[model samples]
Target: MNEIETAPSGEWQDVAARDQLDPDFPLGVEVNGQPIGLYLLGDQVHAIEDVCPHAEALLSQGFVENGVVECPLHGAQFDIATGKCLVEIGERDVRCFPVRVVDGRVSIKIVPV
Candidate 1:
């Protein structure tokens, strides 16, 4: 289990340790019970909804290259840093979460629907 810390605004929740993340891969984690995809590009970590907006594929399960996550179902690519659908196969854009690194922990800001 990981320790969770809430932010002053009660939105950002600590989800995982920075050391636990793989720089070469994307990690799937739950923040406030919502599935999220965590990607480590260079020294920065980006957070987006785990489910691809275009299909039923998990972004964490797809191939990640150059800060872009490619959907395995249709080859549509999304920019993890902005959650923008780079190659639009449909009118779908992934939701992005605000990410922060505090004291070696990865914190994600999750807004309830």
Candidate 2:
């Protein structure tokens, strides 16, 4: 399993390797002790909160169509790029993080809400 965990003192946390991630699937990782979903499209990577705000489902297990990820629990759709709740099932927006690739590894900058 990927070993992404809480970063110390709100620092950027190294989550996973670029080579280990599947471009079509969202990987669930932890950043600053919070669950985050990671997605790769072409050379770009995006990060969002992993849990669906509408229900108790992991966004990583959800389906990504176009730029939106549909929540598996209730079919709520969330935009991967901006973490917007496109379907409006929930008023809450998923927290998005700034991602970086350094030396073939992926790191995420956690921003507190």
What are the lDDT figures for the candidates, one per model? 0.79, 0.82
Q: Estimate the overall C-alpha local distance difference test score of candidate 1.
A: 0.79
Candidate 1 — which pairs collide? none
Candidate with top TM-score is 2
Least accurate 10 contiguous residues by lDDT in model 2: 1-10
Query: lDDT tens string, model 2, 6-93?
Result: 6674567889888867767888876556788889877889988888887768888888878888898888888889998888785588
Candidate 1 lDDT at 80 equals 85
The CA lDDT at 44 in model 1 is 91
Count of steric clashes across candidates, in order: 0, 0
TM for every model, in the order presented, reads 0.84, 0.90
